[model samples]
Target chain A: MKSAVKIMFLSALFAMCCFSGNARAYEYQGVDIRGFISQGYLQSTDNNFFAETEDGTSQFNEAGINFSAEVSDRLRLGVQFLSRDLGTIGNNEVILDWAIADYHFRDWLGLTVGNMKFVHGLYNETRDLDMVRTFILMPQSVYIEAWREAISSIQGAGLYGDLGLSDMGSLSYDLQYGTVNLDSDKGAARLLGDQWPFEGMGLLVDVDQINVDYTYAGSIRWITNLEGLILGGSTWGYQFEADATTLLDTTNPMAAAMLQNNPGFVDLVGPLNAYGARFMLSPSEFGVETVSYTASMEFMWRNLVFAAEYMRTTYNIEFRNSPLFTTLEPVLSANGVAVQDGTIEVDQFSSVGYYASLAYRFAPWFELGTYYSVYYPNEDDKDGKERVAKGLDDQDHRGWLKDIALTTRFDVNENWIVKLEAHKMDGSAILLGADNPAPEDPAEDRYEEDWYLFAAKMTFHF
Target chain B: MKLRSIPLIARIVLAGIVLSAFGGFIVPAGHAASEVMVVAHGSVPVESLSRDAVQEIFLGRKTRWSDGQKITLATLKEGEEHEAFLRMYVGKTPHQFKNYWKSQVFTGRGKAPEAFTSPDELAEFVTNTPGAIGYLPQRAYQNQLKSFMIE
Candidate 1:
């Protein structure tokens, strides 16, 4: 089914290109069509960046096409199809990017329904369009690649409008509520699987189903009286639930010997006796709720552009009906701690991130840009000392990541752009566990704290 | 060594400046003027419009003329006159203008304006299409289109 959809999407793209070669704006029966294609290369000095970047990877690419038509003076309909890949992240999956029906009644009232883009900080909606931005890669603090699909767009309705404020300038607002689709092989699933603590003990997890019950996102930007300056604030929340299949591999002689010698382990592994030697944890409930807020500011003058944004997200997570609880219940009880119905409730924690960027169009065809970004996985454990003491992570630097980046862009022509970027990174807080597997020795560290990453990309749009 | 070669570099710079000044006079002035004139189809109702109103129209915020005709936009692919018109009327550079429209079209906000390779083509399109609006060099004015005075 996936391959069939991919073939159809590619055929449509080829047909569109053949029909319109030189025209960036093409119209057929009053409907407009446009598309973009970009390819990128990435290399890192020490650690992998979402893929196998340490050995240099060229799997980063994006292609998209859209069709839109103005049905009437007050109504418009449009849809876009996108395919992108970054190693195991996107996997070049062809999917519906957005399909929306928009209606406008007045300057202060408009409505949109269907799969609509999510409003985040300043650049989320346009992040995939490399031709429109100066940097090859956006600042990772707020635009984390791991969370792109989860927050890219929502399926529901939104109300957006621009309000005139007289001399105070104009204000634009967007309020949306919807659900997001999460795939089993995507980054979210891998990230969730990494949260299981018993993965080192011949345990493996596969996320079977992930569904976001509902999501709410809102954003308001104030185009201040000062020209070329804008201030904005955005907030979003999500309630998600998922089920996973966990298996204990008893084929390993070490696991079998331990199971036989350790009677306490039998009590935990006995309930999950389904497949001869392999135990399974089916119908396990995984629940997560998150709320995030961002503050953003952008200023542009002549050939110079400046932007800064900050975001904080709080998460509450739960794991129920898992063997990890049964295995650890005895330990907790021996330590005079209470266990609640074979369930674990992770304490709510917040992650904070911020970045400041500046770009200058030195010449009509060339631009130079730079930014410094920082992120902390747990704001309360910024130093990572508490997390290390609590045995959450092996390295203290895993709690925070700081990056300094420099980039140069060349607008070869109206239809093509090329960019090169370099980054000096200070930590590895966001690397996924699947990409960086745990070492055999429990005391060994798996990731390096300091590293360097370089990227280059070329984009063509019409 | 650097000090000894300073006079040669200065002389080269002076010669380049002199050549550029001479080259400026060689180009035709009739096709590229100091100011840009906004023009529309001769049958349009208004003879003048505020700069803010023109900006709104070109940015896709204002969709129609007061007389209920759908407004069609025409633009030059790229030139000095095109840059000047965008900067003076829309407060955007040619690159910025292109990026703005691209964002609008891809995001389903609006349709892209028709682009022409020359002022003559742009004027011809504006002249034939009803409720059409575009800009060209002041010296490239023709009687086939009506010019608007920006307030």
Candidate 2:
């Protein structure tokens, strides 16, 4: 709580210092410079939301600076450096957010080579700019925080253009093909391990490295003639391989048969009834292929803006070179004990998410916004019965998450902004296990079905 | 205890809001809506342009003109006339206009148009650069620049 107060005081002090500033025109000659920084606080009533929100963490912040220049009439060069921290994710790591050399041969055809931002939904490209967005946290349903780095940008070549449709309207399209860097210790890898129920059987997997073969993203937006309406669709695909290590306990099903038939396994039996012995498994690899698509619409009239989007992502996974076959099978077979020799199987499934949001600038200093968001980890198993049958979760609420959020944004000045938001959430689909560990009791639930989260943020930009 | 300090912060912020309201502190922009005229460089443009065509140019949709000349856009830094141009011609508020260009820049898609501090500087820029377009107060006078009527 004291940390939260300290952050609030810092933000207020920063806002006061920049209150009298004018609109920034950071250009000299032909180069333009722009940058922004923001700090935020979060507190949740029940489950932790990414950070240690239950204790009210002040560990959310982002900073970025960009430089751009028009080399000639047909060419432009631009780059931005960004650093962000959210709980254990970014850890204040400075990364080359985006750098591109863009050449427009014509309005209908342009080429960009370098690291370019990916367009998923309508707002993914602008998600990092706190001063531009209305919410302190965008809807988690469609924009899962865990996958931000995976889809934030692509490194390779992109083709973009705006085609005039005359009376019909105009169409803007972008196509990019490249690969993204993923950190095994980050949220994406942890989220992947949650897909299978290995931990319940005393088997745990730790990912050490992740590599992407290729990623392709494409988007098209139709700016209709109807004054203030836009329709857009975007899709991206990724193929990843992860090297992992596993730990298996004495009572592991694959080892159960070996222990029962052999009397020489009495050394393992004593501990099997006690704290249990753990064996390390040889390294294995996970092959994952994912495809995600989003359909979006946005409308603006006067000071009011409304947007809605539906997103679905499907993953096909195969784990090969399992410890069950490589490590324990040899030991058991040499002792005339037979063990299961196969890989763990996880069926292909798609996750579904959708949200509708509205924001209105009520006054020069005040804006109000609200959104309703929903997410299902498995589109076909919304009730979670299949998960319970498979020992994945103890409660049905784990299958889906529904959230309603309200935000009030205060524009303290032209260069500074402060915002507060509240969320009412039901269910727990994406809460990670690292922050919320399960109880020792097998029947006990790990997460609460209802919770509340509060957020406050302050941003300064020039 | 967890909830006690939050209201304190809220109260402090509320007091700040009330103080700002009565302190005579001026907001950066409450730009008055007005009739803003579109001016283009004399070297390359027609006398009149459709409203749709004007919106396309400012939004960076149409980068080239009918005569195949590259379109260079100029904008005022911030003022009543600047807000007027965005609202009347670009079909967006000043806030929306700023966010739009910022999105393009940060995403490495495109660069924002050149912005000038005063109408005379903007007029000078438009006059000197070929295929340039800008906006000014309806009565603002300029040299060697063609005025386009928004049909």
Candidate 3:
């Protein structure tokens, strides 16, 4: 199946190149064929930025092709196949970007079935299309790379339409409800691992599977009477349960010393904390529900576009630390640790992010854009004191990340684009643990607080 | 030979073929079409269109006429007349109009309108197709297609 798709993708690319300037006539069975290919390079002065950026890497690239046809006056069908690689993620895997059959009953009502793109903010649907935007990377505060695949498209169905408001301009809305296919070896699973509180309690987890019970996305935009002004609101939610393999690593000296010296220390599996002693934990259940929303505004006049958005995501999670470790009841009674039962004492936290951006196309060939974005993992714990007290991290900067980015885009022509971008980062909030693994020494710096990431990319579309 | 020297129908046909080949780019040094006209098929229900209606039709917002006939849209591939028509009637730059269609096509919303590189081809397309609408550079040729006076 993979090789078949690769062959089709390569065949389309070859055909498009041969008929580069005049691909408009390259239609099959009245189906229009269009796609883009992009290659990029990344180099970061301090931390790895999605890829192995510290040492520089060229593993950033994307290619996609779509076939669409208006099968009837009121119905259309389309599908796109995308393959992208970002660091160790994606690895150039062929995936269905979106496949939909749309039936337009009227201007104000339409039904889309099959797989459709999920709309979160103004730019989420277009994030993968490089020629459509001026930035190499979207503001990560709202469009995180790891979360892109998990919510980029839904496999069920959707409803979308545009309503005319006479002098009040118009309104466009989309609603989707469906399930998402999650990969266990992908970043989304690792992200869940990062959230498990027991990771700090000498427990390490490797995600085995993430079962998404349901996912939904909805968006509405008011195209105001004011020319080029649009105000919008969007939201998406998910209910998920994950399975994982856990390692009870208690060999670290601090964890071991705490286990041996604390009041409950000598009683509860103290031998598991022995040097080089690794124990495989028994089966535990992990469940999480997330609700995220964004309010957005964009104004476009002539060649200038200005946009601002604010997003907040709240999480409700529950987990059992160990089913076989004799429960938290015994430990709490011995050390007064306040574990109500056998569960990790966390149920909720919210993250907040927002950014304002502006881009100007000075000429047909040149564009410049910039934005400043700020994100906090825990809205209640703006400072890292709570994290350190909870043993989640050793440094305070892990609680927040702030970034200012600049991008220069050059449209060599209608078919080709080149871009250069630079980001000045102030914190290390969302850096993946896989990219920056923790060391046994608590005093060691896992990530630098201040860093810079540079990126250059070129794309060709037909 | 001067374009005026040809028969009316023949000129429209020749103009269409030449326009398809060169997008009306190589008109005689001293000759140029003046004023753009919004034209439609003779069977279309509306005799004229408001600017808003025109924009809606070109943007795929209004899919059918009030009388319930499906609307077929025709567009010039690219030319000065195309840019002028989009600016005057569609409230969009030629570049913006192209992007709008491209976005729609890629997103599975709809395919782009049938595009021709010649006015004659577009006129011919509009003439035969019911509920068809298009724009052309107004000239002195006696073409037999319904013309819409925009409000």
Candidate 4:
């Protein structure tokens, strides 16, 4: 399957290059083709920043190509193929970014079918297009990299329209419903694995698959009477189930001895020989439901642009019928409470985040931008003291992250752009557990509370 | 080491700001009163259009003419006249205009306007295409295309 996709990608590139040789071919064929390639470098003073950036990784890059053609007076066909890598996040896997058949019936209504881009906040649809924005990385509070795959696009149908209000300005809306395909090795799965409680005992969880049963998103934007000002609101909901496998690392002497001494552990380590391990935990079930809402605004005037956005997401998670939990139930009951019916229900929680950004084009080719973003993992635990006291987390700083970023962009020409950015972060709330593994000492903090991240990127598009 | 480098970075950024401010003054501000005539194919029915209507047309919001004819848009690649016309009629800078079209085309929202290298090319394309609309400097106006009177 991978080779087939590569062949198709090479064929498309060949066709595009052949057509590009003749500038007039697009005019005659009524087809438009465009693509971009970007290479970036990231370095941090401390902490991984989601991809070994502390060691100054060059694994940050993106490449994409797209083609769109008007098939008829009212119909259009388009598709984009993208490959991106950021440390270990994307791994440079070529995938279908978005493919859609859009039909416009009237000035006020349109319909689109197939894999469509998700409309969230203000810049979600155009986040992957590096040439359009001044910053290499968007504000993470609203556009979390971990959730990119789950919210990037939807494979289904959408209804979109524009309503003109004369002097009052205009209004545009989109409603989309579909399912998202999530990769087992990506950020979302790693984040889920970090939630396992027995990881301290040399137990590790591997997410094999995450299937999003359903996803729905809607957005509405108002182009106000004030020129270059746009106000918008967006919401999306998701329901997903994940399959995970846990293994007890016998390399840990304590864990090995405990397993050897307890004969009941044999039942817990079902069919261990098949996995080529001393103990293979029973397959576990993971379920998640989420609803998120965002309020966004953008104002552009002459050479200056200002944007601000706020978002809140509510999550409900469940871990059910795991052998590890069943085996540990009797032992944990002696100390405190044990798993009930082999089920662990993580109580509902809400996360809130916001950011304000400003950019000014002082010269035609040079622009300066800055933003302050804040994120709280749990709105209920603003300072994280309660979480630390309750033993849910090790440090108080893990509850929230505040970042201040400064960026400079230079447009070398119409086709090329270079950007440099610096960020000073006050907390480490969003670092994935896989990247920053748990420490041997329970009392030691696993992450730094303050750090700096620097990035430089160059992009070329045609 | 990170703390000591802050002042150096700040000095560099400050210097850049000063240089950019100086560069901004050298940029050529296009002629403010240059006559920009909105032109279309002779087949078009309307002799005049509102500025708002023209803005909508150029922004890809209005896709058809009054007679249900498909609107084929032509635009100059880049020039003083192009800057003036977009600023006056579309209320957008050249950079903003390009970014807007890029977003539309890349996102599958709309097709980009056919761009011409010069006024002659723009005039020729507008004259040949039946439902074409464009703007050109007054000097490039010809009899083959009809000029719309801005209301």
What's the TM-score of chain B for every model shown?
Answer: 0.76, 0.80, 0.75, 0.88
TM for every model, in the order presented, reads 0.86, 0.87, 0.87, 0.90
lDDT of 3 by residue, B57-120 (tens): 9988888987888899999977878877876777665566876787777677787899998998
Candidate 3 deviant stretches above 4 angstroms? A1-4, A20-25, A254-277, A321-341, A439-442, B1-35, B138-144
Q: What lDDT is reached at residue A288 by model 4?
A: 91
- Give the top-scoring candidate (lDDT): 4
Query: In order, what lDDT does every prediction score?
Result: 0.79, 0.80, 0.78, 0.82
The parts of candidate 2 lying over 4 Å away from their true place are: A1-25, A249-278, A323-341, A440-444, B1-33, B142-144
C-alpha DockQ of every model: 0.12, 0.34, 0.10, 0.44
**Fnat per model, in the order shown:** 0.09, 0.38, 0.16, 0.33
Error of 4 at A282 (Å): 1.4
Q: Candidate 4's residue-wise lDDT over A204-292, tens digit each?
A: 67899998999999999998878789899999999999998777776666567667766687567655544454467777888999999
Error of 4 at B49 (Å): 3.1
Question: How large an RMSD does model 4 have?
Answer: 3.4
Candidate with better lDDT, 2 vs 3: 2
RMSD of each: 7.3, 6.1, 10.9, 3.4
lDDT of 2 by residue, A299-332 (tens): 9987889999999999898766543544445553
Q: Write the per-residue lDDT of candidate 1 for residues A82-195, one digit (tens) a residue.
A: 999998888788989999999976656789999998889988888888887888888889988878888889999999887757567678889999999989778777767766
Position A105, candidate 2: lDDT: 90
- Model 1 misplaced stretches (Cα beyond 4 Å): A195-204, A247-279, A322-327, A332-338, A441-444, B1-33, B41-50, B64-71, B128-131, B142-151
